[model samples]
Target: MVLSFLALSACSRDFLDITPDGRTTLEEIFQDEKRTEAYLNRVYGSMPSYFWKYGFFDFLAPFSDEAYAYSGAALGWAAGMLTPTINPLHTPQERGKGVYHWGTFWAGIRDANVFLANVETANIPSPTNRERFRGEARLLRAFYFWELIKEYGPMPIVTEPFANDYDYTTLTRPTFEECVNFIASECDIVIGNSNLPMRITTEAERGRFTRAVAYAIKSQALLYNASPLWNPGNDKGRWTRAAEAAKQGVDALTAQGYALVGDYSNYFLSKTDISSAPGDRETIYEVHEPQIDPVFSIINSIPSKPGMFKVGATPTQELVDSYEMQATGEPVILGYQDEEHTQPIYNPASGYDPANPYVGRDPRFYATVWYNGAAYDNIGGEIHLMETYVGGADQLLVAPLGWAFTRTGYYLRKFIDPKLQSGQPEDTRWKKYRLAELYLNLAEAENEANGPTGLAYSAINTVRSRVHMPDLPQNLTQEQFRQRVRNERRVELAFEEQRFWDVRRWKILDQTDKLVTGMEITKEADHSFSYKRFVTEYRALWADKNLLMPIPLTDASIIPDFDLHQNPGY
Candidate 1:
């Protein structure tokens, strides 16, 4: 993998560094359709390869409602990290930037560009294959832009393959508008194409691109633009474009066979079971792999109760508390009885449960966060354990370790099947886009366009209904409705790799805390240290200029032009 990455990076130093060295010219490469499809397959795989490390700072990993984080782990690191929740920092795991994995994205982008340049002339025998190639390129291109917009803001929008003499190295970044408009327009073309599937008809063709993926991507981009975090630099047009694009994507995907999976949790669990149903009527778009083929895979997220990355919860506690209780339809915070605990108040009048932490919580929490006592059913049977890190020096104070981070206080169980352990690593693919996100996106777009329209309410209600949460107050405003949708997105999309970007675009980092400084009691009322029973408290832990990295201070010192022009606070 390291050699493969290095070889790819040797092609281009810009954006992602994964450019594989192929002696064939662009024209020569695309002449054969099979090669073209194989190249595009790598493009989809790149999303996961990039996303795996991306869980740290790729603008999607840390965007939860709980807390924010900081580190050079990624370019958009500051904006997404450092929110209100789990505030862990200065660990050995903080190299940031999802830096090394970027080679895969850039390499894949290079392939897309090289393949796209020759796509017009491809003599592929089937007309369907031809259109599919075009759609794949368009979708992958959109996917690349997804990274660009989140990381570099409005990066130079590159569509056509560039020449060696294009003088690409000296250019400054593109205007955010220019970049966004280009992405939005391309999605329009991709979404308009009719050759893709909303639901696959064959076993081998499961993870390919579809019209729904296009629409889902467009909605995501549009929502980012519409967000106040990116907007209010007078971005009305961006918001309108986002609304329109999302509407188009939604209308088109919904028209072609997308619907909701009745039990949102079942999608992940059932796929690992052969007896499980094959379709989620609600899935507008998704990326899947059943057998872990190298072409396109998501095995990184499929570890056991104790995973490889003994890292603790990547999810901030703030995100954990955002899910509304099914009965009350309100924020659910798991409080600590300790005086050091910072969870507002735990009284019924304060609106939360102190003893029954997991009861009546956000459905996604149970679905995503494997609490200390959460029981998960896998391929063979049930495994009762906590999703935390209880290894290393201070393992005494922590929970058990898992593949990624140790389950900080809670392990991420969302995409992982309760029945599928790392032992079996069940074939349930690390799913990308499903129907729930589409509904959330629609609610968001509608709320942005007209606040609390019936459309927005219905969209949000559909999602809440699945988990048994009641409808919102009838008189909510647009902003209020938008907040509801935003909160919904936070809980629903937790750990699925959308949080980081969501928080960045929402620009809520500065307004929230970025650490999980909860207090756990070691001493009881009798002044005896509680052995297995300790009290844990929650609060912001640190305040540092490090919130925004110094542009890889070392990189800036070497590159004169970058200078001390740091991001806002760093």
Candidate 2:
């Protein structure tokens, strides 16, 4: 098999760097212990970065109702610009954009396969290292497959490295069931055969895949297969399998000392360099970026100062409305009276006063959104409240539009430090899989499989209790419980790239993606802010056809027979 690899960067740590020349043959590299480890690290680097600086620091958030991407940076899907020929996320790297695509996925898988095929040739002394390295490669290969299955539905499963003369035209896509099963089986192999530890105890191996991560992959894959988009029949068997997988995952993670941290807000900001950090134990797998990067603080956050980049992403009022009231555990906005969502049908018992909209809601709301008059930080050792009202310090930009401001009348607070200065580094880690998600996954799967069971309630409550939010009512029907579980998942997992796929998998994108609303704050002469809801943008182009991403036309043309059928409505 012929294999190609990128020349490893010299700035990378000793174990990850290879020679500058890309001509280093695989056979020659795998013969040395350090080179073999470097090859494995290269495979690890192929994992998707949902919060990279490349995609304007917001990958999937802007596509969903959670947030709005400013300046068309990551709003192609929302603007109806996504096509087989043109996808912002799948654009070529030469354009300095592409986040995930066929080329990256396939190349990553090929590298993993090459590493697996040649790892034994290396002169590594430790048996534990050899076992862990093999397990990591297997899990990463499955991860790439899982990503492909999510974006483009079914895909051809290539286990081994392809030959130079391999017939690309002969390849055919597998069934969705087969695709899901393949990912689950690969993760299973890593769990059962490999000696990979359940959790990584050392800070040095923070991002490495563990047995908890494998379980997370398996649980998530099964849950997606059981979702409405894939399992249209509401297959009880599929949900049962998914529930079981998620339960196993949760149990394994808990046994390995994984649990939710006490402080919800600070957990996200905990530094990964310390093994004893508050949230470190809960993170199963995470994507690491430069902690000091401006993308986290300046780009995707409120404009605290001048000459900063235009606000990249701003939280939507729809996301703000999803956070339940703490007093009654009721949704603030029951439903909208019109398509524009200006008239919210408020629940009388929830105590959600439109005049003072930011009071007495879920504690998570304060952590996730920076609304009008919210205390931002102690700038210059004095408390500075965010002024998003009309003509306020952080007011919404209207004319002369390129100013750094919020289009949605709200700034992102999740994963952003309020105190991070312009030159300061923020501890922003894009958590891919965490213990909380495992519980949510189990809750959703259990509720679907067996209506509103104790297991489902327990799983969901675990996440809610972490944020000190009230438990969901026990008398709810299966559908009601499902909604609560979804809401819990939404508020807890906001801005983590889950909402984009969650809406699609639940087959509710047609309802949720059409329009996103924003809070229009106007400060009165008395300095009291009056809030009005208005439509930020109309996404008429987002329809049922957008449920699945299209296989890029460029990739399809490479196959001589063109047998790789495009997704429906592409």
Instruction: Give the TM-score of each candidate.
Output: 0.74, 0.91
**What's the true lDDT of residue 318 in model 1?**
53
Which numbered prediction scores highest in lDDT against the true structure? 2
**1-570 in candidate 2: lDDT tens per residue?**
101122333312243344335556566777776667767768866665556343544546777898876645456666688888877665433212226566778878887888888777666678778877888889989998898788888888888888888998888877788999999998989888557878766656656777878999999999999999999999999999999999999887787778887778876764544454434577787765444444545333332332256666778889999999988888887788887788889888787888899988899999888888788674455667888888887888755467477888887776656675542245566678888998999999999999999999999999988877788888999999998899999999988879989999999997798988888788888978778888887784467778888888878777654436677887
User: Residue 371 error for model 1, in Å?
Assistant: 3.3
In model 2, state the lDDT of residue 317: 88
In terms of TM-score, which candidate is strongest? 2
Q: Write the per-residue lDDT of candidate 1 for residues 66-153, one digit (tens) a residue.
A: 4322324321333344322211222123213224332444555766776677777875777777787778778788777766455535
State candidate 1's TM-score.
0.74
Q: Which stretches of candidate 2 lie over 4 Å from their true place?
A: 1-8, 11-23, 52-54, 91-100, 273-279, 291-309, 560-563
What value of lDDT does candidate 2 attain over all alpha carbons?
0.76
